[model samples]
Target: MKKAILYLVDEAGVIQGVQLSAELWKKAEKVVLPLLEEPESQELQREGPLKDFQTLMEYWDFTYPYSPRVRCPHCGASCEDWRTDEKHTFILNTANLGGLLVFHCTRCGTTIRHKHFKDHMSIEHTIPAKYKKS
Candidate 1:
Protein backbone atom coordinates (compact mmCIF):
# COMPACT_ATOMS: atom_id res chain seq x y z
CA MET A 1 0.00 0.00 0.00
CA LYS A 2 1.47 3.30 -1.11
CA LYS A 3 1.27 6.30 1.15
CA ALA A 4 -1.15 9.02 0.12
CA ILE A 5 -1.73 12.60 1.15
CA LEU A 6 -5.36 13.38 1.82
CA TYR A 7 -6.43 16.98 1.73
CA LEU A 8 -9.68 17.99 3.41
CA VAL A 9 -11.30 21.30 2.58
CA ASP A 10 -14.54 22.71 3.79
CA GLU A 11 -17.14 25.00 2.19
CA ALA A 12 -16.08 28.62 1.87
CA GLY A 13 -12.99 27.59 0.00
CA VAL A 14 -10.87 26.73 3.00
CA ILE A 15 -8.05 24.28 2.64
CA GLN A 16 -7.81 22.44 5.93
CA GLY A 17 -4.42 20.95 5.00
CA VAL A 18 -2.99 17.80 3.56
CA GLN A 19 -3.03 14.57 5.52
CA LEU A 20 0.03 12.46 4.82
CA SER A 21 -0.21 8.72 5.02
CA ALA A 22 0.92 5.55 3.32
CA GLU A 23 -2.60 4.34 2.70
CA LEU A 24 -4.20 3.67 -0.63
CA TRP A 25 -7.29 5.68 -1.44
CA LYS A 26 -10.54 3.87 -0.89
CA LYS A 27 -12.93 3.49 -3.79
CA ALA A 28 -16.13 5.51 -3.67
CA GLU A 29 -18.19 2.42 -4.33
CA LYS A 30 -16.58 0.80 -1.35
CA VAL A 31 -17.03 3.81 0.88
CA VAL A 32 -20.62 4.56 -0.16
CA LEU A 33 -21.90 1.01 -0.29
CA PRO A 34 -23.25 1.15 3.21
CA LEU A 35 -24.49 4.66 2.72
CA LEU A 36 -26.36 3.75 -0.48
CA GLU A 37 -28.32 1.18 1.46
CA GLU A 38 -29.55 3.71 3.98
CA PRO A 39 -32.87 5.47 3.32
CA GLU A 40 -31.32 8.93 3.53
CA SER A 41 -28.39 7.91 1.34
CA GLN A 42 -30.77 6.23 -1.10
CA GLU A 43 -32.69 9.48 -1.41
CA LEU A 44 -29.45 11.22 -2.29
CA GLN A 45 -28.75 8.68 -5.02
CA ARG A 46 -32.06 9.57 -6.68
CA GLU A 47 -30.49 12.81 -7.83
CA GLY A 48 -27.71 10.77 -9.34
CA PRO A 49 -25.25 8.10 -8.38
CA LEU A 50 -23.94 9.30 -5.09
CA LYS A 51 -20.46 10.73 -5.50
CA ASP A 52 -17.65 8.23 -5.16
CA PHE A 53 -15.05 8.60 -2.44
CA GLN A 54 -12.44 9.98 -4.82
CA THR A 55 -14.78 12.63 -6.20
CA LEU A 56 -16.05 13.53 -2.78
CA MET A 57 -12.51 13.64 -1.46
CA GLU A 58 -11.42 15.81 -4.36
CA TYR A 59 -14.30 18.19 -3.83
CA TRP A 60 -13.33 18.31 -0.21
CA ASP A 61 -9.76 19.16 -1.10
CA PHE A 62 -10.20 21.87 -3.72
CA THR A 63 -13.82 23.00 -3.73
CA TYR A 64 -16.20 24.87 -1.47
CA PRO A 65 -18.56 21.94 -0.95
CA TYR A 66 -16.73 20.93 2.20
CA SER A 67 -17.69 22.77 5.38
CA PRO A 68 -15.22 23.96 8.03
CA ARG A 69 -16.73 22.15 10.93
CA VAL A 70 -14.72 20.37 13.58
CA ARG A 71 -15.71 18.62 16.74
CA CYS A 72 -16.85 21.09 19.36
CA PRO A 73 -14.08 21.36 21.89
CA HIS A 74 -16.55 22.11 24.65
CA CYS A 75 -20.17 21.00 24.30
CA GLY A 76 -19.60 18.63 21.41
CA ALA A 77 -22.63 19.76 19.41
CA SER A 78 -21.46 17.81 16.35
CA CYS A 79 -23.86 19.94 14.32
CA GLU A 80 -23.93 23.00 12.10
CA ASP A 81 -23.52 25.35 15.00
CA TRP A 82 -20.01 24.04 15.25
CA ARG A 83 -19.51 24.78 11.57
CA THR A 84 -18.45 28.07 10.10
CA ASP A 85 -18.54 29.71 6.70
CA GLU A 86 -15.02 30.98 7.16
CA LYS A 87 -12.36 29.55 4.87
CA HIS A 88 -8.95 28.07 5.79
CA THR A 89 -5.94 26.51 4.10
CA PHE A 90 -3.54 23.71 4.95
CA ILE A 91 -0.42 22.74 3.07
CA LEU A 92 2.55 20.41 3.42
CA ASN A 93 5.85 22.17 3.08
CA THR A 94 9.39 21.26 4.02
CA ALA A 95 11.40 24.37 3.19
CA ASN A 96 9.95 26.91 5.62
CA LEU A 97 7.72 24.99 8.01
CA GLY A 98 10.18 22.07 8.15
CA GLY A 99 7.45 19.57 9.00
CA LEU A 100 4.96 17.22 7.40
CA LEU A 101 1.98 18.81 9.24
CA VAL A 102 0.10 22.11 9.30
CA PHE A 103 -3.55 23.22 9.53
CA HIS A 104 -5.87 26.06 10.43
CA CYS A 105 -9.50 26.99 10.98
CA THR A 106 -10.85 29.59 8.62
CA ARG A 107 -14.10 29.74 10.53
CA CYS A 108 -12.43 30.70 13.78
CA GLY A 109 -9.47 32.26 12.00
CA THR A 110 -6.94 30.37 14.09
CA THR A 111 -3.66 28.98 12.91
CA ILE A 112 -1.54 26.25 14.35
CA ARG A 113 1.88 27.93 14.39
CA HIS A 114 3.75 25.06 15.92
CA LYS A 115 5.21 22.49 13.54
CA HIS A 116 3.92 19.29 15.10
CA PHE A 117 1.10 16.79 14.66
CA LYS A 118 -0.09 17.24 18.23
CA ASP A 119 -0.54 20.97 17.68
CA HIS A 120 -2.49 20.31 14.53
CA MET A 121 -4.81 17.96 16.36
CA SER A 122 -5.24 20.38 19.21
CA ILE A 123 -6.37 23.02 16.80
CA GLU A 124 -8.34 20.72 14.53
CA HIS A 125 -10.10 18.92 17.38
CA THR A 126 -10.76 22.01 19.42
CA ILE A 127 -14.23 22.88 20.68
CA PRO A 128 -16.18 25.19 18.42
CA ALA A 129 -16.04 28.86 19.34
CA LYS A 130 -14.36 28.00 22.59
CA TYR A 131 -11.29 30.08 21.85
CA LYS A 132 -13.30 32.66 19.95
CA LYS A 133 -14.62 35.58 21.96
CA SER A 134 -17.97 37.11 21.18
Candidate 2:
Protein backbone atom coordinates (compact mmCIF):
# COMPACT_ATOMS: atom_id res chain seq x y z
CA MET A 1 0.00 0.00 0.00
CA LYS A 2 1.16 3.54 -0.73
CA LYS A 3 1.91 6.02 2.10
CA ALA A 4 0.91 9.67 2.68
CA ILE A 5 3.02 12.43 4.15
CA LEU A 6 1.93 15.37 6.30
CA TYR A 7 4.42 18.23 6.49
CA LEU A 8 4.49 21.04 9.03
CA VAL A 9 6.75 23.99 8.36
CA ASP A 10 7.67 26.90 10.65
CA GLU A 11 8.56 30.55 9.86
CA ALA A 12 12.27 29.64 9.81
CA GLY A 13 11.65 27.05 7.07
CA VAL A 14 12.22 24.12 9.42
CA ILE A 15 10.04 21.21 8.38
CA GLN A 16 8.74 18.14 10.13
CA GLY A 17 6.28 15.52 9.02
CA VAL A 18 5.17 11.96 9.23
CA GLN A 19 4.71 9.40 6.53
CA LEU A 20 1.88 7.03 7.25
CA SER A 21 0.39 4.03 5.58
CA ALA A 22 -2.72 4.71 3.53
CA GLU A 23 -4.89 3.22 6.28
CA LEU A 24 -3.29 5.29 9.04
CA TRP A 25 -3.42 8.45 6.89
CA LYS A 26 -7.18 8.08 6.60
CA LYS A 27 -7.52 7.92 10.37
CA ALA A 28 -5.20 10.91 10.88
CA GLU A 29 -7.14 12.95 8.33
CA LYS A 30 -10.36 12.26 10.21
CA VAL A 31 -8.85 13.70 13.38
CA VAL A 32 -7.22 16.70 11.69
CA LEU A 33 -10.21 17.62 9.52
CA PRO A 34 -12.31 18.96 12.38
CA LEU A 35 -9.40 21.06 13.70
CA LEU A 36 -8.79 22.55 10.24
CA GLU A 37 -12.41 23.71 10.03
CA GLU A 38 -12.43 25.36 13.44
CA PRO A 39 -12.84 29.12 13.54
CA GLU A 40 -9.63 31.12 14.02
CA SER A 41 -11.17 33.10 16.85
CA GLN A 42 -11.70 29.88 18.77
CA GLU A 43 -7.99 29.19 18.62
CA LEU A 44 -7.11 32.73 19.68
CA GLN A 45 -9.56 32.53 22.56
CA ARG A 46 -7.74 29.49 23.87
CA GLU A 47 -4.51 31.52 23.85
CA GLY A 48 -6.17 34.27 25.91
CA PRO A 49 -5.65 37.98 25.21
CA LEU A 50 -2.42 38.74 23.36
CA LYS A 51 -0.23 41.11 25.40
CA ASP A 52 2.99 41.02 23.51
CA PHE A 53 4.74 44.35 22.97
CA GLN A 54 4.87 43.85 19.20
CA THR A 55 1.13 43.18 19.15
CA LEU A 56 0.47 46.39 21.02
CA MET A 57 2.83 48.28 18.74
CA GLU A 58 0.98 47.02 15.72
CA TYR A 59 -2.46 47.88 17.08
CA TRP A 60 -2.92 50.73 14.64
CA ASP A 61 -2.16 48.44 11.74
CA PHE A 62 -4.69 45.85 12.84
CA THR A 63 -6.75 44.58 9.94
CA TYR A 64 -9.62 43.41 12.14
CA PRO A 65 -12.72 45.62 11.97
CA TYR A 66 -13.24 45.71 15.73
CA SER A 67 -11.45 47.97 18.15
CA PRO A 68 -8.46 46.43 19.92
CA ARG A 69 -8.27 46.27 23.70
CA VAL A 70 -6.66 49.59 24.65
CA ARG A 71 -5.28 50.62 28.00
CA CYS A 72 -3.35 53.55 29.37
CA PRO A 73 0.32 52.88 28.70
CA HIS A 74 1.32 54.90 31.74
CA CYS A 75 -1.24 53.95 34.38
CA GLY A 76 -2.37 50.67 32.84
CA ALA A 77 -5.97 51.77 33.35
CA SER A 78 -8.87 50.44 31.37
CA CYS A 79 -10.51 52.32 28.46
CA GLU A 80 -13.71 53.13 30.36
CA ASP A 81 -12.97 56.75 31.17
CA TRP A 82 -10.78 57.57 28.19
CA ARG A 83 -12.04 60.40 26.03
CA THR A 84 -11.90 60.05 22.25
CA ASP A 85 -11.20 62.97 19.95
CA GLU A 86 -11.37 62.53 16.23
CA LYS A 87 -9.39 65.24 14.52
CA HIS A 88 -9.71 66.24 10.89
CA THR A 89 -7.02 68.37 9.38
CA PHE A 90 -7.84 70.89 6.71
CA ILE A 91 -5.49 72.82 4.49
CA LEU A 92 -6.77 75.81 2.50
CA ASN A 93 -10.15 74.32 1.53
CA THR A 94 -8.74 70.81 1.17
CA ALA A 95 -8.95 68.12 3.82
CA ASN A 96 -5.51 66.55 4.15
CA LEU A 97 -5.83 64.53 7.32
CA GLY A 98 -7.06 61.02 6.65
CA GLY A 99 -8.22 60.76 10.29
CA LEU A 100 -6.87 60.80 13.83
CA LEU A 101 -8.31 58.95 16.78
CA VAL A 102 -6.96 60.41 19.98
CA PHE A 103 -7.52 58.68 23.29
CA HIS A 104 -6.96 60.83 26.33
CA CYS A 105 -6.18 58.65 29.29
CA THR A 106 -8.00 59.96 32.34
CA ARG A 107 -5.87 58.14 34.87
CA CYS A 108 -2.53 59.65 33.89
CA GLY A 109 -3.72 62.26 31.37
CA THR A 110 -1.57 60.97 28.55
CA THR A 111 -2.72 61.59 25.00
CA ILE A 112 -2.38 58.87 22.40
CA ARG A 113 -3.21 59.40 18.76
CA HIS A 114 -3.62 56.83 16.03
CA LYS A 115 -3.15 58.29 12.59
CA HIS A 116 -5.03 56.64 9.81
CA PHE A 117 -3.23 55.72 6.61
CA LYS A 118 -4.42 54.39 3.27
CA ASP A 119 -4.22 50.76 4.36
CA HIS A 120 -3.10 50.91 7.98
CA MET A 121 -2.53 53.27 10.90
CA SER A 122 0.33 54.65 12.95
CA ILE A 123 0.44 55.45 16.67
CA GLU A 124 1.81 58.51 18.40
CA HIS A 125 2.29 59.38 22.09
CA THR A 126 2.19 62.91 23.43
CA ILE A 127 3.23 64.31 26.75
CA PRO A 128 0.57 65.33 29.22
CA ALA A 129 -0.82 68.79 28.50
CA LYS A 130 0.13 70.09 31.89
CA TYR A 131 3.79 69.22 31.44
CA LYS A 132 5.97 71.61 29.54
CA LYS A 133 8.56 70.16 27.22
CA SER A 134 11.81 72.09 27.01
Clashes of each: 10, 0
Clashes of 1: 10
lDDT of 1 by residue, 22-107 (tens): 34435444675676444221111111212232243343333234333443334332334221322212211111222222223332
What TM-score fits each model?
0.18, 0.33
lDDT of each: 0.34, 0.45
Candidate 2 lDDT over 1-134, as tens digits, reads 44355667778877855557678768888897787544222211111112232244455344544343355565555542221322111001111233455555443556666565656767666666566556
Candidate 2 achieves a global lDDT of 0.45
Residue 40 lDDT in model 1? 24
